[model samples]
Target: MQDLELQAVESALTDLVDGERRWATTTLEQRRDLLTRMRELTGAHAQEWVDTAVQIKGLDPNSPLVGEEWMSGPYVMAASLGVLADTLDHLAKGRSPLADVKFHDVRDRVAVNVLPTSVYDELLLSGFSAEVWLRRGVSRAAAKAEAGLAQLDPSRTAGIGVVLGAGNIMSIAPLDVLYELIAHNRVVVLKLNPITDPLLPVFSKVLAPLIEVGAVRIVTGGAEVGGALVQHDLVNHVHMTGSARTHDAIVWGVGDEAVERKRAGDPKLTKPVTSELGGVSPTIVIPGRWSNADLKFQAQHVATQRLHNGGYNCVASQALIISSDWDQKDRFLAEVRNAIAAAPERAAYYPGSDDRVASALESYPNAERLGPGGGRLLVDDVRPDSAEPILSGEYFSPVYGVVEIPGTGASFTAAAARTANEVFAGTLGVNIIAAPASVKELGAAFDDLVEDLHYGTIAINAWTGVGYLTPTASWGAYPGHTIDDVQSGIGVVHNAWLMDGIERTVVRGPFRPAPRSVIRGELALSPKPPWFVNNKTAATTGKRLTEFAADPRASRLPGIFASALRG
Candidate 1:
């Protein structure tokens, strides 16, 4: 991998950037045309993308992750950059889909995503409930991104976007790339993390359409490469989904001179920076009464969120906040253990998941052990105040060590909320789990929790990671943030619409997840998940979802409708 010629790629990138700049500054129709071409290519080459994932990207042939990466990965990259929609039509309006289904028109007129909200809606929605997907345009958000760059502000500060790729997740790099290139209109130089470098060529393949058109470029190397990236004259905006230590090095550059610059409150230089840095996100349960099914369902939901992606995600709920007197915590914890035991041991992508787990167990010395497929740790009430730094340490293992919250001292919700506000590491997501009883009693508090958390996405019972899987949801740092104190990385990613006004988007799902799920991480033995309707039909269903998202009313609907029938 290291043998790849560097100079040739760099030269190619210079040419690519030139082309993108011309397109960005040019007319809207041209940009839209390029984006349309991107969409066509994505649909045309969908199978090739799946093939890349299977053979080159180390994906399981049957895992939902493959199909997801195909849609959100290469497909959404075009949706973000190739089709930049910075301007809005006057009196913007459009038809809306039923809300219960995951559907939204994020673009002007109508912009169906390669993977629309409907896939999730129909997949997750249950009962006879009807859904209406939102019909919103990108006018406000586009206006916001274009807001401060007026001619009057001569110093329109620009930052070179440094996307430090996640070694484990292929989608993170593309998401970072899009946010920098399209959402903020900044030039991006993406540094592939060492772990995932083997898959870089595969990404380049999926992105070939955009790359040929000069939308983005890729570079490969190690920490030295990353350091060089931050220091590059072209890079001003820095975003990474890695360890807190990595972030500290950037905040206060590493060596003596760097530390001096950081201490002085001004580095040798400064530009806008933002990130959803890694951290131990919290999943909370409000004390509540619930049916046995509800208790089991909510517990499994939280467990799967943490267990997803091998527990190396920025948004995984590292902390499980159970009400002091919830009585059901025992029943819930057991189910969580069962679910963790069910998830396959994913390759630890984060640099130090094992060490992080070791530290947790060292402090408590009583972490529970589970799992038939991989090494795992499960704990209960080890250290609510262990004098240990959960946020400071980096972990690369599948361990769910619990900390008990006294029911009387502070309600579980209050305690969990405090942790979220003050916890260390990155702020990506938080899942608040409560039975209907709790919601009914403290609905206002639930709303308050949503507003109070600094996370990028707040999911009630369902994991917010599901939101990232939904193209309709916007993924990135929370609103009202600047580079200096970016709770998460700057700007939004995976948002095809590029909503100009939204700082962070909150997506709420039902307490009990619907039967159709693509995640194969938790509560399952084989790659075959019970939620996929008929497991054999995953690929077909995936294709239909992609098609339906592209043009819901197109005559192609028959194929998608037929697939749904077959499923």
Candidate 2:
């Protein structure tokens, strides 16, 4: 992609900033109407958006697995836009969007229940729940102080911001734009990741209203375009969802010179920046006596977490922590391997997946290749202190490693959480799967487990992606990370509730997810969750799910179930 001329780039940014000034000053009523239009436009163009993504990614357009595109593409975008519009509508009526939200004190922090925004939300995403924990000393009155800030902030000035999008997830780029435009009230210029630029037209079309009003602009190019926009004077703030290497290159320079600059505490750009970079995420499995069926079910849960998006996700479970003392440990590992073997092999579609997988195999020759055509890797017997490839590496592929500590209950939980925080090199997301009995056994210590895990989002008996799908829950690395030791980069996004000073989000769900339930499962959640890369009806079912979410009706429920069953 050729970089646009400097003059043209500057002009576009100026136009966006001017439009953003108007956007920042809009009354709640006007802002609500604008977002309502955005939701409608996005829903209308949903199909084209998914289709383009499927085609560009070389997936079968007619296949149900195309649902991956729908969920990651139009579905997430439409869902997020709808949530933002609802927040604005509430604010226009002089009510806090989180007026009915529940909160409970946990030691020094307050955990705010941010899910189930409406009855429809609970009904649609059954059995799933989310809570956002505020940083210490942040009172209830100040919790959502910025929720009603459609008008200008007296302490802050309105200006244009730039978003450097991620190519792996279709929802990321547009969602980043939404965070800037709706939450922060900044006009935005979103530069598409060249790898996924084929969907640019679809994005432009869906965002036509915003484009016409000059509230947003869509740009296309590679590193040169990103550098120009990042260094431009008119851009007041910058947000990016990419790699830590990319973040360093953008903040410091590149090569040996950049390393020295970083060591000296000097950066190229002084403007404020926020980012969501990749990490080696972890999942902890508390030891407990379990029936074979329960073992089999949780194994599938762990497999789906790793194999989702071909393991391209930043939140994918890369490190699996278990207790060596558990009697069921061998059975669980066997079940995990069986599940991975039975699942269909997905193409290593991401740019570096093949090379990463190959490198991992060479480093750990004992690694077992699971699934058809060697599409998945399972490296077992990884000791807690071993310098294994999976321990320090972010494979970014359909690869997972298992580490066993010696203990049970609180001892195991503490060791696992500490290892996840200190050894993994990221505070992005972590998962904990424990039976109700096990949690009851630990009692108050369970709270300690939740508090000690230094991650932006934590999932209890669920995948971390569930937290990502919940809009009110903040999505980013944990706070207190610096540019010099930038693990998982920095900053938060997708916080539709307009909260500030967020520490982390915790989500809890049923450990067994009821039998034959639509939203829960041992083998799969519902009949077919599009996240399973092997789901044959993913495209159609995903499309149906998105439509139902966009405009929920009792009549649409049967069709969604039918489509899900077909896959």
Candidate 3:
């Protein structure tokens, strides 16, 4: 918005391009040092950042908002720093390398600088999922950068990189910027979403080094600012981690131009663009024989997926595609509604969430409202509804509705297969809550579901959001795309492993949980509940989770024992 800022951004891009030669030559050690400095600055200044996030956004430090603040708090901050360290350390020893991809004798990758902007204190109870992505992402970028340096195209002119950030999450912008720079070696000019612009001063403080290095800079404004940036002559590569609507507008270049472009096999602009647009994910509850414990654990798991982020995430379990005839289906739906109702009221992230919820009710007069306060949740008991039509609409509040349409003999399995084809939000994750018998009976069907589901990440008895948290999981829209058909996004993000993978990631966990439910106890937005397995004992559970994540298959017994013993 300022002339000086414009001048600085121009200068920054010029410097980055002028210094391209040194980019490949820049050692991983140097990059690591920059990341280290960023982590330290973020951790040290966590409180100020927290204060800024809270005050500027005027977000309540109660229930859901507090939990999100926790992501910015110490837990998230420390974890981000740790993962970053772990990633750098992985490269410090020269572990994995990927240099095969080349384009016109030019390397398109560079070391991405992950700026940790978490407020550690608030998130102490909750685990930081983004850390899982960032830590692994940095190392992957380093490896990519190493290979890119070898395939450098000295004559290739660098392109303008435009990044439009997400408003709900704190580190999304920084991480996206890091990816564009480190993953593709592109210089970046990031535009802050207006919703969180108040935190600019603090973010400016945290990202000073990126600005100082002339690799990244931030510009603040609204739609006009974004439109101008996208339209800028120097800008070439565009990236946004927000709404599908925005991506559509950007790809087609909003208005009459967009309409014209759609008519052809082209967009308003032909330039290469990438995005991490939201998804309307589904959680498939495969029916099978299970004890009460299995039902409880899986029900809670589904509830957590929808409840996280105040139920505003693109990947939130929008459609509970289940076998309507499964005997446990009604019970599962009941428990899920109860869990959602029991959940405390959350602050809606999207600006018009309240209106959206109200509109949804008005649109579907039959939708039943739940929770202590009716606004907390609304159960829209859906019956096919013209094959998953609710998914076409975006609901912001924690509404745990059921679509209990009939399934054939493999009621659950068959329903999952059917819904997988119909749901909106191309990016999705299938949550399978099943007993061992069910897994076996439906393993082949599950395999096909994995092959068939359009989701980006598939989780088992847990929220797909965990995939986003795991750091190693590749996050992106489903890959089969053409300009007009592009659903979720064009590329992937937070993939630390850098596996050129085609298979959808499946996160498998225990069927029935040990009493210590992380989400209910420590990770809850507020004080620990007495029944929360985590409330009575967090240390025991934390250690178990740590071990489980470190080594799952090999270390199953302890995990089982811990779960059985209630941690």
Candidate 4:
């Protein structure tokens, strides 16, 4: 490494040495105060953060689609600050964060209701609910007993951690830093991805409280800096949000020797590492009778799943799974095509996006380029057993394919689940869309299907991204993956409840939007969610929601409701 780069890394480490000790013994009240200040600063700079991201991605500032940046960037950060502060408040009082939360038995496993914890959540995110399912053999009492940092031995001194930030979403790095500092009681040195290094000013300002206290440090560079930081003697733990290839390079040295070392179960870096590498996630659609409106609305929903962030998201739906026997399959497919074509156009800003899209086109000659500038590609009617790369690879672009299973009802759902598990690349998340009536018809079979799928986060009648946005829900790949095959990574973050032994998070939303939802007997009051790409008022709603998340009040409800209803 160059002298200056090496000095920078050394300085960061040296600064954090004392921080690691100071933070480990810091009182919970002090930590909560830092979070409160962080939240205030984040809200103050939220607009600037969103505007910077908008310019970086070449998005129109006037377009509603700027809401994507608002929601994914500052909104999530602000919400997470509040949630983590609440957890610390409970810990300061010597109580479990999940003390009053409801727990229920699902197939003999304990599932804790983590959402709607406050009246604000019920109003702001009505019709949405989330539950964190404990890993098998974890009883409810054990869950409460092990929740938060208080459970650790008081004299145990926390060490410094190195966090590798993600490029796609601006909030990911800061959120990971928060998790490391509060949840694990570790000081963090967060290295921003080169692609998002421009946001260093915004991050520094927003995270000033932590930085001033030496509890966190933000640095920028490519692999060389990250490599040096992770392997540094002072760093005791490592967390990253990126690809599996990158993770392997850091854990096992790169090249032929790296391959052999992985094979031999030996690693270059001996410190504990946790990551959130993405995979080729699937969107499974159950067969159901639907009105024309249902077909149109759901088509847009699926389109949003694939096209959000121009399909650069780690959890972006890459495979569309449907039952061949559904009579409306043709209509639904047509609607999806229309939705993809009609969605707003945006730049494919991520590195190598064009090449990934081109690779998909080369692999499937019949792929359709739907959006303007030919950036969106969709391959329909893909066979489950086909050797196509799009079916199993995480393209991380505006490219997706459809696979059809031969059955209906519970049999098709079961087969689809099996195919997703067997054929897909990673276990990060999966989305299942079923009408309320269709789910009712399946009865306990629906619950059984959910329990059987081995994904970190499962969404029924909603996008898994919702699970990511919910600060309390655990987000990561299903556990049991070893470093040799670290598919979609090995650990979870953003779990504000601070509960351990988490298997996965299950999130459910209304099958239909607002008025239509009520008419269809879903009884949900939520309108078209602001996160949807097609929501016209998303930018406004997202901004208002961020403000509310920072400083929640009854007075802010009217404006939020008004903007959301318009969307």
Candidate 5:
């Protein structure tokens, strides 16, 4: 607790609160203008932002990973700002953001189609469909009533929001700030994670409009600075995107005493704290008739899920739930391993990633090592009765485990869903991959399985990471989790539709999307996504994609495609 750092944090918080008070009374028109300014600023600084992250991550400057950095950085923030501006613009015109809401009746609550709000969305993300399913007893009408009300009348909300930014994703902090500004109508003071301090200068320049107006403040420091800001009297609320362990430390005290404090229900801070935490996400594979092509396609899908962030993602498929009785199960598993081994290795850039991977392998010495490096170890052959560390812990590394169920078809899907809900720890995101024929056969039972799963986002034949990227979808753990027993932390973010009472987001994609479609596939998918570790030109394609997203031009398509083809 250095007095110098503490004093700086206090001064920042004091100024932030004053600005937020003024912001609380700001008109919808003013908010709209601010967000528009932010969007344009973000677009202008998009390239440098991506470059900074890629350089820090030790990635090749011109690699496809540039796309990864861009998409998860300025691209996401820019998209969020654009959506928020549109929502605010609607409010200024006295139109509800929910007036465009479309709903489909699932087994329990209705699934609200929030994205593809226009033809532009169809162009940007083709076949990548997203929907938010409200908790049971929450109706579409009720949800619409709550949508964008704060944006319409922000006089009711005023405060200084402290955002503990995530180091893993560059877009996370900016998006968190945007949520505070647009959704909650709070002025924000964002403290960048130590790992992301390098981006502070870029953020400062990009967010200059908001900072100049005192609506947003960007700071860089470690936990000491965060602690001071969190405890500051001027801070009205807190939002974090990190681990549950970090959350516990912030909510309670640190060290052994913190565990006891949590047990005793003693919290250090009682302010309204919302978070987007990590998870040991599971992918349930429903067994059915399958061809060699299906096996190859699904294998690539699961491999991409695990290797997306070098398996550093909270929504990475930590556990694979498959039916042992299926004839193609072994072949599918083999294909998954092959896909992982085929991809080029990414540097284990995140701190403690190597230690985490090593520890998991130590726990299961017999785990099969995949790929060139000793980083990715598959836990397919582990005894089910043993203490499986892979299922129990969220390994923030390129490690994956496979759990086998005895049944097939509907029974297999049901068992997998139950296991994912009860066995795996975190309730953040879960994946279900099933053949179309199998899904149709399950019928009502499939709906029931979706209703029963206790996860925030469930992707059918898709990764929940896609759901997290979808601005309309809510990204958080399933509801009904307590602070002491927070599995994947509390609350949600990136929800542009302003839909209320959201329990989960279900993003459905084809098992094998046609090439060149929004969803990636083997054939015609024009640009190889940078997230695929094997993609050679990730940086170049990623940059082009970011530029196109910021300002679309058909002329840029051919070059982007050519770069991807080279990869």
Candidate 6:
């Protein structure tokens, strides 16, 4: 490394040494106030943040799709700050963050309800709900006792940590930094991915409070800078949000030596590391009797699952699992194709997106190219037992393949879960879309089906991306992976509740939207969610929602609801 680069890294770490100690000894009230100030600044700069992301992604500033930037960039970060502040507030009051949360016993485990903790959630999110299922053997009392910063030793001086940021989403890098500071009690030097370095100034301004205190440092560069930061003696831990290949390169070195080190169970970096490496996530469709409207809406939902952000997301649905015996299988597939064809066009702005799309085309020469310019590709009837790369590899682009499993109901559900757990590459997340009536008919069998899945976050009739946006839900791969075979990296993030012993999060949303949901006996009032690619009022709703999250007042509800209803 150049002397200048090395000096810069050393200076960044040197500045954080004292800050880390100060942060460790800070009272809960002080931490809460810091977060509150951060939230206010986030609102102040929310527009600039979204605009920078939009310009970076080559998005039209006036288009509704710019709302994607608004929600994913500022809205998520603001919500996370507010949620963390609320958690600190509870801790300052000498209470568990989960004091008002409900817990239920599911077989031998306890599931803590992490959503709908406020009237705002009930009104804004309506039927959406999430629960963090504690690891087996954790009693409800143990969950409460283990919540929040109280678990940390007061005397131990926390050290500086390094966070290798993700490139795709604008909020990921900042959110990871917040988690390291608040959840793990460490001051962070966040190295931004080169692709997203353009937002450095915006992030710097929004995080000025922490930057002034030396509790946070944001840098930008390629791997060399990240390497120097991680290798610095002052850095005690590492957290990254990127691909498994990068994680392996960091932990086990590279080239022939890295392979040999893995075989011998030796790592180059001795410091503790945690990650959220993405895998080929699957969306399982349970067979059910359905009307045409049901099929079309779900088709759009599945399309959004794959095509959101042009399929550049870590949790985007890459594998479509369906029951072969369903009579509407062919019809639903046709509708999905139509939805993909009809969706708005956007640039595949992520680095190497074109090459990834080309590779998928080479792998499946007959893959249908839907939509204008033929950017969206779909491969149908992928054999379960075949040596297909799509089954075990993550194609981080606008490409998805369908796999059919035999049987229906419980048997089909079990086989689908087995295929996802055993066949898919990563355990980050999975989505199951079953009709409300079908789930009701399955009863305990459905709950057992969810319990059987091995992914960190499971969404029933909802997208796992929703789980990521929900600040209270724990986000990561299911525990038990070792460093040598780290599939989805390690540990969790966005867990504002701070409850320990989390195995996975289960999120559920209404099967249908608004009046249709009400007509079908479901009372959820949520319209087409603002995150949907097709939502016409998303930009307005997302901006309003971000402002509301920063200062949640009842006066803001009518505007948010009006904009959302128009979507």
Candidates in order have lDDT scores of 0.54, 0.79, 0.57, 0.89, 0.79, 0.88
lDDT of 1 by residue, 406-488 (tens): 76223556667776666534566677766555676776666566566776666665567655665445676565554445455
Question: Root-mean-square deviation of each candidate, in angstroms?
Answer: 7.1, 2.8, 8.4, 1.3, 2.7, 1.3
Cα lDDT of model 2 by residue, 1-567, tens digit: 243446657778978867866665667777667777777777788888877777666765666557777787777777777777788777777777767778888789877887766766665555667899989998887775555453324124358889998988888988898888777777899988888889888888877778887889888777888899999988998999987888989999899879889878889878889999878888899888778777987888888788777788888898789888999999999999998787655567789888999998887788899888876889896766536668776788988899888888788888887888778867899999998778889998888999999999999988888788777888999999988878887788998877778899898766764454333333324443456555667777778877865665788877776765665
How many pairs of residues collide in model 6?
A: 0
What C-alpha lDDT does candidate 6 achieve relative to the native structure? Answer: 0.88
lDDT of 6 by residue, 435-534 (tens): 9999999988888789889999999888999889899999999998878889987999999888789999999999898978999999799999888888
Cα lDDT over the full model 2: 0.79
Clashing pairs in 6: none
Global Cα lDDT for candidate 1? 0.54
Estimate the overall C-alpha local distance difference test score of candidate 4: 0.89
Please give the clash total of every predicted structure, in order: 36, 5, 22, 0, 9, 0
Models 1 onward score TM values of 0.76, 0.93, 0.77, 0.98, 0.94, 0.98
Top candidate, metric lDDT = 4
lDDT score of residue 225 within candidate 4: 95
lDDT of 5: 0.79
Please report the TM-score between candidate 4 and the true structure: 0.98
Summing lDDT over every window of 10 consecutive residues in candidate 2, give the lowest-scoring window: 516-525
Cα error, candidate 6, residue 489 (Å): 1.7
If candidate 2 were superposed on the true structure by all CA atoms, what would the RMSD be?
A: 2.8
Candidate 5 error regions (>4 Å) = 1-4, 382-387, 515-531, 535-540, 552-567
**lDDT by residue (tens digit), candidate 4, 495-566:** 988889999999999888989888777768999889889999999999998998888888999999999999
Model 5 per-residue lDDT tens digits across residues 512-555: 54552333332223233445556677667666766766665788
In model 2, the clashing pairs are 64-537, 64-538, 64-539, 67-538, 67-539
Task: Indicate the residue-level lDDT of 192 in model 2.
Answer: 89
